[model samples]
Target: MDLPGVVGTFFAANTIKRECQLLLLLREYVTSLTMACLVEDQCHSTLCDALVQLCIEMRSLDSPPALIRTDPASGFTALCNNDLLKQHRLSVRNFLRESEHGSSKKRIDLSLADKVQLLKHLQLPGVSQASAAKKFGVSTSQVSRLVKAKQQIFDQFDTGNHNRKRQRAGKEEEVGSALFLWFQQKISQGARLSGPLLKQKATELAAAEGSEFTPSDGWLSRWKSRHNIAYKKEQGEKQNADFPAAQHWRQHIIPAILQAYNKDDIFNADETGLYYRGLPDKGHCLKGDELVGGKKAMERITTLVCANMSGTEKRPLFIIGKSRQPRCFPRDPSRLPVDYGHSKNAWMTGEWFAKWLKKWDGELRCKRRRICLLVDNCSAHPSNVALTNIELKFLPPNTTSLIQPLDMGVIKTGRVTTEAD
Candidate 1:
């Protein structure tokens, strides 16, 4: 009448015919044993006798008799159910094997950007720590740690290294910080920065800080990745620009000019060359074959752009063409989209600049306004122009690429817009 033996036989048979009756009888026996121990203060022998009687009544009708054995050491009789004991041992072995395999697996690591995205997801309403952990395939404690370290994660976020999984601290972190500040200042002044230049600066900064740090190509690359810095191709003579002169002008000369004039009264003007009918420099061809095309059209024009510091006013573009009256021109010159002028080479000349400045000066005089005009030191832009209503300021020679607003993507944007049209 062993209960475990009777239950194991029915389970092996895969029958549910007597499951409800067995469950009800077991519940009744458990309740009676509890009440007898608590209310009647039953002795140990009385409880054992009650358990044996309950097991005998609960046994199935067709189950084989359970084996009875005596423990020789304790002199106690016990029921032996081999099938139930074997099944229990098998389940325990499987559980232990799974635990060993799961413990041997490696843990997944999240990147800084992934942590940032997790933080964003967690910030949304109605999301709990357990839910976030499940969604990101991480532990709840890991999610909690990330929430606590959110500020540090955000401070270290770099667009260039979004996929980088590890955070590392360098010996020259102080030098990098100072160099990044210098880099930002130079960029604000429109200086064209290169890798070698940055490396030299880093070395100098490290020396100033009394550190024996050598700036290598690898270090420079890591620093660039950390700060999300990139290089851009600079066209024309800007690569060999006078950055020192530009820095001097920005630090000393520009402040005085800015103090003297209001932002609305300050203006900058520059001219850019455009090949109005040029073809695209790229083409598609089959593999192992050269792309061939006809000679590109080089019909070029010069356009002048002028704007105020506050961006409150933009003058109509001044266009210069090679022909005074080209066949494409309408009968009336004033009907053109831009203010039209002409030169032999379709370029701005000293005479053309002087005339344009004088015309603008006259207009300002009529309005009773005295304005400061900033222009780069091109040969066409003269410093000796006599104007009562305009104070002409020329940028430092060879430093136009570093300090001139027109050359700093402004003209490029204009040319792109024109091409799109």
Candidate 2:
């Protein structure tokens, strides 16, 4: 009875069998679990409680046992468009018929289903005399007589509305544009009309405009709301890499390079968007109502955060940036653009840090030796120049947050970059 395909047979016997089997398995599993709890000496407290409840049943001297209905759930029986009771009915029927050959053979034992099912298997759907006969489990002659009577009655009642699809109707090119403009006008005017009123309004308009009319009701009202376009974008999330950089930092890099420096001279540095999750990369988003509102309102407009941490002291510097997309060098020395604007900010790159190291340790004799700079293992972080002055143990392959102070809490996480990036 899987019968051709699942949806093929409107009420396929196979579908019923599957539904019954699922419920059977669920009931069996629950029973077995309850039994296990009873038989085992070390059963969990909750399982024992469930086992006790499972034994509640009514038995009589000469009748079938009745279920001791404990508490009937009281509330709305209909959940929106969902019918929980109908679903429960399938399960309930399966539960009662456990003695049947197997749960897999359950089906709707109804006249309509039987007739339709036979007709489908026989490759006949037009409901003919002979087809109906075999389909309905009746004599062929009997079906022929019933069909003939119905056909005669139908012939007498020929309605013009029957089989409209057979009409070879064509459409004009401007049909769409005209309909949209007309509907928009009606909606803007807040007009509401039905049946005769709708037809009368259309006729007057047609006469004035010297064109025919097409009036349809309930069509506009049922359309999707532009205001409720969709629920929050069910978009996919982006990932920075195969394994999080934070993982690499935690497992491979920290123990080898940064832990020793942590006892004396080590500090973490990073920057973040002024906006709260303006970039939803790798950070916790504002929950509840904050997210319920528009995403644009949370966008950081003109600010960047430069943060540094040493010992327990945390420094937060809010910097703003200009809208120009130019690459600048620390040694560019070209009198930083006067009109770069007050919002514009800058950071010294790896190459600049290297030269600064040479000046401090070689030329200027600054006594900052054996210094460890805790930074992410981004390609930008470990420059040849920076390595010459300060030792940067590249964060282990994929670790970033597990042990890295930056990903842990010191600095805010960045937006999850796409794999293509």
Candidate 3:
């Protein structure tokens, strides 16, 4: 370059590289400038800023600056004097280019121009965020963000079928397509059994595998609109007793209590854990916060409980056997910190219950009134020894939910009431 319109000191190879491409060209120009400063002779945030200014003030555009630097020196004033040069010299001097390829199997086309237009074309063709992410080797969120910026046109997930399949309660597993596929496969295989056969197979599978009892046909039909189709047995259904003392109380005692007291004096009593496992965590949990779950959730903490609204003397008692002492509190100074990691030093076992009963017995003798103890018919509470010591009462099966005062009123709850389920 020779320049008649402009005059000044030629910058030592004054060229733009790795620069902002506002004008939709000069990809190589920006790259070269950045590489010029990036390597042993390369750039930084400051150097890069200077390089951009230098690119804007070359002699060919107009009069050149006397020296290249960030400070507003003599050259800068002289360069800025040319208003035409300032407006057009380096219009595309801000864009930063990134890696040319993406992760997905989609090919990256090296268009001579920037990819914003190509992305827009793909968007107009109904490319989805996930598809665009796959094609561009970016994350789905990145594609979504790009699409939101109008850099591309992306389609959202189709939601019509999902709205159709969401039904009430445990019947949720039955997907439309999965059920259809199951029936289709069944018919295709000549397994068209009658209603009796279908019932029989379902019953057999239910007895054998619990989940398989639900005819796969309906579930497969559900898969058409959704992904999840298989049924999962609810937790602890096997161990749950068909009848609970709380149930008995709600059915018989609560009605009687309701007749006498307007449900408020139907007070119940049950001691719970001070620091049991599965307590609702206190504070907010960040993304990485997790309690290292294991076989621990099912492990019970020993807690004693009794609740009732009726006669004080006829209340049922409960003792969760699996619960043990907390690990946080260090034991006696002489012993190892983990000596009684989860021991009866805290839990009220049968012996402890007997002692506790002895104290209550003393209190009862002083008042000369027989005390009524309302309790659930749990194994530990109903043990021959635990029951013999008190005027024990039991609630009706599953009736604790409705009749339990805790459920009716919301007091300042202390911790997880590990009482019923």
Best candidate according to TM-score:
1
lDDT winner? 1
- Please list the C-alpha lDDT of all candidates, in the order they appear: 0.67, 0.35, 0.39
Put down candidate 1 lDDT per residue, 1-421, tens digits, no spaces: 2235234122110001242121111222222221111111121122234334443454444545432221111001111222332323211011222345746533446656567777888889999989767555467888899899988888777434554557676658899889999998998787878888998999899899898777899889888867767667767677678979999998998899899999999899999889988866666679799878888788999989999888898988999998889898899988988788889999999888888888888998899999998998888988898999999898888988788877788888877777662
Q: Please give the distance, in angstroms, between residue 46's alpha carbon in candidate 1 and its true position after superposition.
A: 75
How close to the true structure is residue 239 of candidate 3, measured as C-alpha lDDT? 36
- Model 1 stretches with alpha carbons more than 4 Å out: 1-111, 114-140, 143-160, 166-239, 282-292
What are the per-residue Cα lDDT tens digits for candidate 2 across 114-219?
2233334345556666644433334666444434455432432242212121222223213323443565577556454344543455455555667675644432
Question: Candidate 3 residues 140-234, lDDT tens each?
Answer: 66445555644222111122221121223324333332344455578556454454444454445455544644545554344332432223344
Candidate 3, which ten residues in sequence have the lowest lDDT sum?
A: 91-100
Off by over 4 Å in 2: 1-252, 276-310, 313-320, 323-365, 386-389, 412-421
